[model samples]
Target: MTPAKTQFSLPDDFNPETLMVAKVTEFGVFHEVRRAAHLAADLVANGAPADLDLAEQILAQVLDRQEHDPADPHHGNFYWMREDEFVEDLNAVEFVLEALIPMMIRHAARLTPALQERLLAAIKLGLMEVARLDVLVAYTNIAALGVLNTCLGGELLQTPEIATRGFGKLLAWIDYTNRSGHPLEYNSPTYTAVTLRSLKLLTDLTADAPTRQAARALTARLGLSAALHIHSGTGRWAGPHGRAYQPTIVCETAPEVERLRAWLTDGTLPRWLASFVDRPMASFSIQETAERSRGIALTTHQTPTFALGVASQSFHPQANVLMLHYARPNAPRPGVLYSRYLLDDKWFGDAYHATDRTKMLNLPDEGRFLGVQEVNRAIGLYAQIGADHFASAKGVLIWTGRDEIDEIWVGEECITELPHRLDVDQAVVVARR
Candidate 1:
């Protein structure tokens, strides 16, 4: 078959100005990720009925999709509509190949060594292929291979090769994230859950390997970084500060989600990973410039009743601003977010995405939570955002609004600039749900 030519012309109505194509995923694959993940979790928890029959069935489904044409055309083909699909695909591979396949081979009686070898070869090729296209995802793909090598054999196919690079890079990323105090993986709202699953896979797969100790350390540090957002009252996520969330089928109905719920409700990660995390800290702080050059500086304060994720800038010119989460106890993983902005709840209503980037302060950070406002520049319309350190019970943000913009925003939703040039200070308090 002749290679398909790639060509496209923007339509007359297409607005290049409005298109932020990088944020979109041309296809969705997380449903299978979640399903495959749940199957693995179930097998781990308790599922040896008939030599792990249920687990085997799930593994077969994943392998079949490995070669089959996906319902979404972008998935099967080498070419992609956008780069994030590459991310989606590699993440999918992490769930199935890195995650499910290893668990099955380790425990399930039905998955033979011969079958495992075939799957490993195919996965290796996919990682190489995708690496050629997008190296970032390849970084993760290498970690996936490391995991495969760990479960299948000590001296597996790619040992001391791509496996080493992948493990090393991932550890470095964890180190940078923790040390710099910057939000990671795009500083995405749903990222904590997404990343937690991956770390869990890596940690569990390499249980006996040389990399296990480092992997466990990275996992613990990452968990702490993410846990800063868990709310004590509502147990929901804070808000989408970076990219707005892409729809994923990894929902509450998933068995894995249920398992996580059970664990968060009364337990920590399986004893091994949990050994370090131990108990939730009273409060921890994170302040840094994010990895992708996006600006983010935030702090988390956890009281027995409320875990507050606090930040200076909720929106900035370069970085997606931070949104704080104060969750109810035992709510759920990736719980509903506590809003950071004091929006007109009657006008805008209390929604999860409400705390997204609105026209706000562009306070650049020099480090350690101080965003200096010059009064001349702004992220969009708002001039500056900073936390009022005077009070402790509620969140108080001191903001300097744009004085010249008059009535800022498009129309009815538009906010009127403050009559005065000084910062408008208010307290951000979370209610007990």
Candidate 2:
């Protein structure tokens, strides 16, 4: 069942048995192929889409997001050289191509010859051009190119010089993912999607022996990470880790529907979509500890209704502050269970619905997340509410058991709690409207 080596032209050091698992139990990429296949079958049985405009619409959307001019993609996942005019993210293009791959799988049998040719040509051209531009974006982007190139046919490898560079780059990417505990240095729900999608393509497209050896291993690790991080119940990614956008909003420009409109129509989407992974994920469960750099320790937990991702203060920094993404609330996009990461940008952190914000002055930086569940980031640094200064608010309610309040300088900004002492080991505080 394995394809020929000539098709992949892999590096000599590759290994074939990398990360081979007993069975496949993941989603996302797995279901993506299913969706594509379903669509292809429907098209073949019913004929091409009546609305010829669908293709054009997807194409246009991709074009709009292209950083044809090197503007910051604002949402970045890692460190990379920047150039003003260079295109930054081709994710739109990546999505369109991935969306088309499933249909391409059944093209010969179901698609009209002309339709197949045009669509294939368009998809191939889009991927190749993006590949060229991706040479600048980042390694992950380049890996995106490598996966696309190999799957569509060894076209990028058609020329010897280009082939050497192209395949070589993929080898390097595989090497990086394998050597580093967290291949995705800056993890995010969206970036995880990108990484998983690329790996999915690699699993299917590349040759058997050499090229996939290292790729298989990394794919397995990344795949496990994806399963653990996502809420099985809601099907949404966990946390706004590193660089991520609201998954439901698509792109931030167009808005009107309250869910779609920027938080205040004051035209600031970040304000509204600033909470935790609020959407519903269908089945949730913890897969494993996500291994990352700095011996950071993070554990993932999932149940049918919700998911919990905890990072040891010593290990995971950004997300270590408690994060809970749910699939049970059955709510709209601006999902609740807000994340502490949002508190990083203090200026914009006050999500209208969020209350109970507090800070601890004496805790070590690592322990800060324990007492304070809020966070705000400046440029790249973290700033919190109760860390140093006093924050004033209204209708704050606070209650706790007999445990002495940590000799932490106590400041109750809002007088919401009854003065009567309650009995217990835990503290309960809820800011009411």
Best by lDDT: 1
lDDT of 2 by residue, 283-345 (tens): 433322223444333445556665455443322322323445444253342222433332232
Query: Which TM-score value belongs to model 2?
Result: 0.45
The local distance difference test score of model 2 is 0.38
What lDDT tens digits, residue by residue, belong to model 1 across residues 1-433? 9664333332343222322122212232213333444443455435344424444544454455453334443342121111222323433444444454455445544455665665566555544433443334213323434344333332244345556655655555556566555544434434445555555655656534656666566555555544444433434333223333322111133323233444444433434433223345354433434443345554444444433343444443222243333333453432323222221221122222212222221222211222322121112123223444322222223212122123433322444443323234532222234
Report how far off residue 141 is in candidate 1 (Å): 12
Q: What is the C-alpha RMSD of each candidate to the true structure, in Å?
A: 14.2, 16.5
Off by over 4 Å in 2: 1-89, 100-105, 108-128, 135-142, 150-166, 185-187, 205-209, 212-215, 228-322, 325-381, 384-433
Model 1, global lDDT: 0.39
State the C-alpha lDDT per candidate. Answer: 0.39, 0.38
Question: Could you tally the backbone clashes for each prediction?
Answer: 17, 28
